[model samples]
Target: MTIISVYYTAKMTDADHKELLEARLADIRRVGDTVNLLTVIEEGFESNAVRSKNERNFSKEVNPYVRKSAVVGATGMMKVTVASLKMFSKREIQEFDNETSATAWLRDELEVKA
Candidate 1:
């Protein structure tokens, strides 16, 4: 199994966002060993934005390594949520609101890795 680091759980206030981003950066920078896998959990509008920005930031922070961007929110079944995710970008960023969707992505990526 690939090692993973979960950032933490919190609402996205401006200060918290700054602190979390810095901490995340530090965590990756300090990792003398490479991180093969990463997972982030987010909710709400502000949290969504924070996670989105974090994805971009972390993507830059961890160049050359493939990072998984799994956005967890109420999606699928209802077409609205899918539209929302699509709005983020043209790329099909895998999304989930619960374990089922998340695990599905995990399985898909893991198989590809194998």
Candidate 2:
């Protein structure tokens, strides 16, 4: 599985999104595309426009490689952003208030045999 922790306090540029997507793609490739992801985002988006654009770009590129995703530490607009992303994605996307809960849910959802 691929796990990512994102913490930022400024607007993300297209290049930033591209670089992140490339990294995620590389991770997926390394895992042979059978991947679940846990993304803990802290203060990543400064505004709705930035969140929407970034998520849109991510959904286009990374969603195909993800089988499921758990988004932790999301609140307010970020919670809304995750919910909106769930609408168009074929893969499952869930939000949580903490990493523990998110990881537990992901384990259950993916039926991890560990």
- Clash count list over all predictions: 0, 0
lDDT at 67, model 2: 80
Kindly report which residue pairs in candidate 2 clash with one another: none
- Would you estimate the TM-scores of all the predictions? 0.47, 0.69
Cα lDDT tens digits, model 1, 1-114, are 233444434465656666766675676667655443334454433345555565556555654333344445432232343355346543334545564555556545433221
Candidate with maximal TM-score: 2
Per-residue lDDT value at 38 in model 2 = 80
Mind giving the per-residue lDDT tens digits that candidate 2 earns over 21-87?
Answer: 6676676667765567787766654446754676677667777677878887776777777787788
| For model 2, the run of ten residues with the poorest summed lDDT | 1-10
Give the Å error, residue 50, model 1.
8.8
